[model samples]
Target: MNKLNHDQLLSLEHPFVKIPVEKFRSSLRTSQKHIEKEIGNLTDKISEISKKSVQGSMEPSQVEAALEAIVNRLSTLKRKLKDIRADEVLYSQRTKVRLQHLQDFATIQTLDSDEYARWSRVRLNRIVIDYMLRDGFRGPAALLAKSEHIEDFVDIELFAQSAKVEEALERQSCAECLQWCKENNSNLKKIKSTLEFSLREQEFIELARERRSQEAIAYAKKHLTPWQETHMKEISHVMGLLAFPPETKCHPYKRLYDKSRWNDLIAQFRSNNFALQFFTPEPLLNVTLQAGLSSLKTPMCYQPEHRNANCPVCDPETLGALAMDLPLSHHFNSSIVCRISGQIMNEDNLPMALPNGYVYSYNALTEMASLNDGKVTCPRTGAVFNLTDVKKVFIS
Candidate 1:
């Protein structure tokens, strides 16, 4: 036999490959339903015969003949069902064989002993277990950890807490999340996060909207007042909400009563929590797969003969470079890049943080300052600042 290449060996449309397992399974289910209908008919006939016998409406000879006919029909249905099951088994075996062939063809048989040793040194399985736990698949993570004897490596309790916090957020109640944030407050503050205050503000808004003005005032005094210097305007706006009847349609105040704040707070809490735990807000695996899909969506990648050939998207030399070029964040478009030049900050074009904390490229800020004759207004927040107020940030 001629040695076949990977594409020919693993081709889904190969003549020897059986129909898809799902199609076979579906056919079996249809045959089973037919058999069930026949069984139901037999059961109904038996019930009718019993009723007739009880009422003395049918002779024993006639009943015996009816039962025999039903039994024969039932036997035939059973035989058909058995044949369908056999076909299912045969197809399942064929599928297994096809999968085995594909797996064998796809295996990296070219690796030498040194390369194999290097590959074995990398604990990818543990990384997968960690990924599963981090992504909230606790059951699978626990099972894998235990089976692999890596229970000491995984923090099952932290995973559980994360899951619980997520559930609470989904229900629009941030009480549990607030407690978690309190425990991680120091770390969150290091990141200059507004998460804790944001949660309190959301809660305060809820109190005012529910017509508990006194409680809302008390809440603000205890919580919102401490952050007043940093969030003074926001604190004042939230406090102004108490003056309006909850149903008032006042322009800016109307936004205070928007119910979406609850959802916004929940999302903010999750992002903060992830950051505190040293995890990216987005799952690494999901981001990688999305980037891969985006890069490989060109028509040439899906052609039949190209399956055995090197994929342009997967070329070793260009793969890392392409990934590096992908936007740092999925929400890159909405990120605080230079709105004027539409370019991200780089080492050469370091960002300057304005008074409002929005960063712009140093060059862009310079141009804006020159245009305004000394002071520049923030394109994002619309806050005005003197040229001297712009502080260059060294982003590592």
Candidate 2:
């Protein structure tokens, strides 16, 4: 496999840059279903009335009543169609604005100085806001976004919607979550998601744990019964919990009543919702940082003695710690820089190896020699060497 750096991978496959066609399609599908159902009902009613007329059983009064009803249905259908058209136009305008912002990211380098500054400010704010939102620091995120006036670029509302469901899940209430599941029931079923079933299971467990035997049983019969075909084994396992008391020493049943299950449901809901909306599971800040750090990481960065004070990858406080798990950049050829001159040792400025195994560019050694009576000192070790003794090294 060809190893691509984070920048390349993100440029090619970042979820943020991708158009949310699935989300749009999902909304359109709901509207299409409603419109089709209405048309179907209207046609069926018309067909029935026509059959009555053909049978010669329709009175004049019935004719007038049928005509009024048909006109009313037609009017309602027209209104619905008009509303859908308005919604479509509104959605298109919003999508175009968002697309314009996304395009700016790609063409930012081509912008003028003032434009670049404004874009950079918005981009930085967006990254910070994204990180804050993901970490549940919505108060701070909202403040920062409002102050910066970048709310339109950030996904504040999207995160808030999912956060509400998550908060309900945390409170041990599956109501909002279940409603969300119902709204996206078709998509969930298509993906064979276990989220809804899991939520129902948690509900049953909660009732059983509270010793509400009758209520638990009724809940299982109504909510859990539908999951039998796909989750029969799981259903059997959970139903067995009722036989054992909530305080029973049985490990399996005890685990079912664990409070951590709510956290699990919250996580599942976030993951499923993010997937549905085509949002990345991780914060964009973390993703961008990882990519940047990985591109700068090297084997020497881990060694304390070889560390550079100005190097981010060598600073243990922040970036270094973050880049610990990242792979080093792939380099087919080695690069050496002069310690004294801060210049690369290439064909023109050849590297000179000292007796102490330290390397410096020939130009740096020459400059040091000119000042130190033809004696060069190694920056790291502080060892002195005659310029004549420093052998020129050639890198293959």
Candidate 3:
């Protein structure tokens, strides 16, 4: 048999011929445990010695010996702690080397020019900054802006206010968000948002949950009653909740007491706030990740030997079928297809506007006309129309 060198034996376990991080960590933990046990025993002996000294049963020699032992154990613990710190530094260095190796393996050269790279960096920076601000990382956003010298582009005050509003909402207090809504009352009213009323409703529920039914009723009469015209059903439902005890487990009314209501209100407030600010509801990073994932799900992305290799291309033909698989709310109103034919409007299949203003693909309208003997009816409004009245809508 051939004898293996030290380096060869080490390389068999670790590619870099270094101790694994897990083993190093385990050794550190074991050393720490031993040191801790020794310190704990020394502490117990010191406590006993102090008690004996207090009772005048311990001699001076006994106290001196106990003190010496404690000092020696503490010195050993200090040395162990220093060794642990050194090991941590080593682990960090090793981690960097491993990361570099992985990066080298996964490296791919972009075919784009330097300008494209520059533009990508700028876009990525903006997305990260927006994500930071949107997620209530004002301090980090500010620091990043200052570092990148883009402080002029970032509205620090606005981000700070947004952070405050988010924090208040997280704590189940809508004071900050309500104040923002009050300041932008005119704009909110223009959008026909019920954010203010919803916040008041949450406060009323909170009051009711605290067993202050009288105060909750008063709050409803003062604040919630005005919105009765617009939200009568919701108002009635909430008013009915007042009849039962705060701790009532009644069917529909019981949902009013759930903590999730606060979360829902918070989400609604955030959505309304984003609308008022003319910002997208989702962070750019989140939207980018979703789009990337959706793209990756395409059949073209699969390898020839992959399980989904025979999957159909993600084209218009398959879009309607895929749309059915997705949640209804996931489809934007502007992007939603005809309810009857399930086809999107394109150049070839132009959008046809009926008398009721409901638009459908021209192909769908033609089919409807053929079926109804040239009399087309809007599926949504049930309004009747003729082929002459169905005009093509040119959407840019």
Candidate 4:
């Protein structure tokens, strides 16, 4: 012990400590800035592209291709940015926790007792989820969703304007069985009633208006005559949207976890508030799952369609036990095959269902781009490291 001086030890330790903190902070700032800048830049490009297209300088195909390219880039960038942001917050949370532990150590140093070691060992992080902590907390989400890519968030079929629907109605070649309300001799006496359902200001619903449109279409088909099918495919198509209800509201993973479990833990942390700054054990209930479901950003116009006085999902007690964060009522049991002949997308990104029968959930696609992220691997190098690996290194 006498061989090395205290100055020598401090020199080595100081750099090892300072370097990690500096590196993580710098990386966090830089990563956030990079994503923010790219989002801004792409937004400007999309605006410019829209202006050029309106000026008739770009072909429809060219405009579409350009938009698709932006979608691809935005997806990649968003996925990367979200991951980076999550990592950034996580890093900060860890550092803050560690710093708290260190502070406790310093405070207990002059007490002539070893309670600091015991206190640090108690581990306080159990009270919160990683995303809820001060360092990683999310602010208001609506303010955050102002990105230009936000429109891509809404997925619907027949997203065309009302003007387009009117044009479709005017085309006599459109539907063999359908007649304009003004020209329907068979229903001349029902003119006023028929006119109420006319397409002058109507909207068309095509493709996947939402995930389970197949159900809505089947429901509509039950009421459609053959002539109705030919004349009102667009109208019948929108009926498919009734299969699933919209998402009306969503909460953060942390809020759900805390809402469900905080009452139980509050009593437990009574006398050891300071001692909790240390190791937070992995939650027994999967926090990530809780967070994922709880943190869902609800879509617009989601009115729960309950036929009775009761909520369809079941009683609050059962739901609470099951996990309040998850919308258990939602089902992904339906499958659809694309009607047109073309390549289809598979979950694993493999070529499947040629000639377009492969089904996709528009909601799933939008959420895939915006809401959450699966782990990433470098396509070329295949480099991957679990967060636990980083945690272990930090702890040691």
Candidate 5:
């Protein structure tokens, strides 16, 4: 495979290349925010300690305690910085691997090479595992990741963290998710996210649902009042829940108390978490498949008579269904892909039509003939033909 110079590779706009580049850039931004926050906290602590000393209130024990606090804070900062460095290394390695995959495609003479096949298999596994992990199929995802030996390449552990929050939400508890929001409070606030406020509002609504009016009021005063500037209207509606019971059919109040709110919260948290981590909220598998199937889609793919047996867009059960709404790929001329070998038919790999009127690539037919006593077998119709009887097909 030929190596791609950096500029040329970046100009191609391939999704495989684009995704990693975006991820690397987002991860850097997240890391920088964390580092800056930590450093600011450390500076604040040191300044507080100095202010006390200058005021002559720094007793020996107090000084000792302050020093210990600073030490612990510094240790935490150091550990976080180390983790950031490790993440940078891992992300850099993966970025290079993906870019190399792009470079490999540049000079590849044939798609049937072992190296190309391996890369393709790895990509499929990664996509499947990613989808599984996001959709709460961790058991199967883990098994697949283990089998493929790509534990490092996939974000299993990261998704596992999200699963915990999602599970908590399913059980109608917001404690775990609230803690996560707290942990990422700074990042979330930077985006002007309403997630934490929404969670708090839900908690207030739950208190109201239980008919604990006093407790609900107290919860609102404590947790909901702080968002007055940004969410005053929302907070007012939630507070109205205190008057009406859960069974009330009031417009906004009833809607707020709907059971689906929990599901919405789960989705909200997942989106915010993915954003924080610089990952797409949608599964990579879905994104990749949609992109691929769209490119291969054509109007003829939907017609039963014109559909090829091996066409992805013709398989009604899976790929076809995905491509149903996708726009067809723009084509100046149609391309024929062999049903047997799954390769495009061109002059080099000429299309050969058997007596049965089914077409396949010459390379596929010749190979099949060599293996089957000088005869070619129709994969679609099960018709057998002598290799000498096949005719080459030409396209204008």
Candidate 6:
């Protein structure tokens, strides 16, 4: 005892004493008897009063007095039982305290164990689905009276249940849940308007998601959600839509990178590897053109530019860029100065000067070019790398 810590010694005052089941049984029985006796007395008084009224022998004032007396007696009986309950709690303070601690330990033990925690959480959540099944929730009979941690447990438990409720709200196809609600009105017998409101809100949320992907993308360019972005990349990868080599892409860079590339290059002027220029355009036409620009034989024959900025080979422009190092975009839009270069010419004949003179010119890469007839404008110097070749660089 001397060696016991504060908690153990404190626990000793109540000593883990178990409340006898018989005592609870007796208390319950007594409570029931008290209520029954009051009810029986009222029933007898009403019977007598009714008889007197039917016989036309009782005065209205007298009858009212008698009824008031019965109501007063009933109120007194209720007050007496309440007092008795209070007295019992006071007299059995030690037992009450210990039992409450026991209840808390039971609750904590049920939750603390990883195995039972999920199950117990599930059971508590059922209250949301089974509110009508709750036994006595208002006063002392509620969970709060029995356990110290009831509030915390309930808050966590409520949060867990809210997800299910939100799902119940969000589902577009709520036929099953609605049917269940009809049969078991306990959880969902609320005002008609509330349910309708919940359903509409969820439907709107779903519609917005659809609009962003399918419709809004056409008007404005934006980064796609991870899933859509991944899918696009996969398609490009499968179709053999590859970017042009640096020198060619610049005119190789000009052939590759774009106006945006120039902006990003200027933005990072002080950086070590200042890009002469950067350009990312779209992917090249994967399909073999019926007539190569080189093969065309006419009075300066050229296939007019397609309305869409898409790669003639690939529908969407494949990412293509030109800079000192690897180009930034499939179109070659994003870029950073990887190294120094002399000049940059785009797929067309436009040449852009590098921001920094030391490495003033971007790789005047002549990657993509067209001749009014068969012009060999852009040329490739280093070994041309295939798509499969670069895949090894960034696989993951």
Q: Is candidate 1 or candidate 6 better by lDDT?
A: 1
Per-model CA lDDT versus the true structure: 0.69, 0.80, 0.68, 0.37, 0.81, 0.35
Candidates, ranked, TM-score:
2, 5, 3, 1, 4, 6
- Those runs of model 3 whose alpha carbons end farther than 4 Å from true positions after fitting are 1-111, 299-396
TM-score of each: 0.43, 0.73, 0.47, 0.26, 0.64, 0.21
Off by over 4 Å in 4: 1-20, 109-112, 116-396
The candidate that achieves the highest TM-score relative to the unseen native structure: 2
Better of 4 and 5 by lDDT: 5
- How many clashing residue pairs appear in each of the predictions shown? 0, 0, 0, 9, 0, 53
Q: Any idea what lDDT model 6 has?
A: 0.35
TM-score comparison, 1 vs 5, better candidate: 5
Model 6: how far residue 89 lies from native, Å: 4.9
lDDT by residue for model 1 (205-295), tens = 8898888999999999999999988999999999998898778899677887887777787677667766655455555444544455564
Superposed model 5: Cα runs more than 4 Å off:
1-109, 298-311, 314-317, 331-396
Top candidate when judged by lDDT against the true structure:
5
Q: Which pairs of residues have clashing backbones in candidate 5? A: none
**Model 2, runs deviating above 4 Å:** 1-23, 50-87, 102-118, 137-152, 228-233, 243-250, 299-309, 314-317, 320-325, 337-341, 345-396
State the lDDT of candidate 3 residue by residue for 182-256, as single tens digits: 877887899888888888878887887777888988999998999988898888877777687667889667887
2 or 3, greater by TM-score: 2
Question: How far out, in Å, is residue 384 in model 5?
Answer: 20
Q: What is the lDDT of residue 124 in candidate 4?
A: 26
How many clashes show up in model 6? 53
Which TM-score value belongs to model 1? Answer: 0.43
lDDT of 4 by residue, 1-396 (tens): 113232422332232134235536756776777778778979898998989988999999998898888888878877877877775665565456545544554455332346643652332222222213222232222223223222111111111222232344344222321243333343334322333222211211221234445543553454333337344754543343343233312232222222222222222221121112121233312443344344331321133432112222233344233444465334345223222222233343222221222222333333333433432222224443222221110111
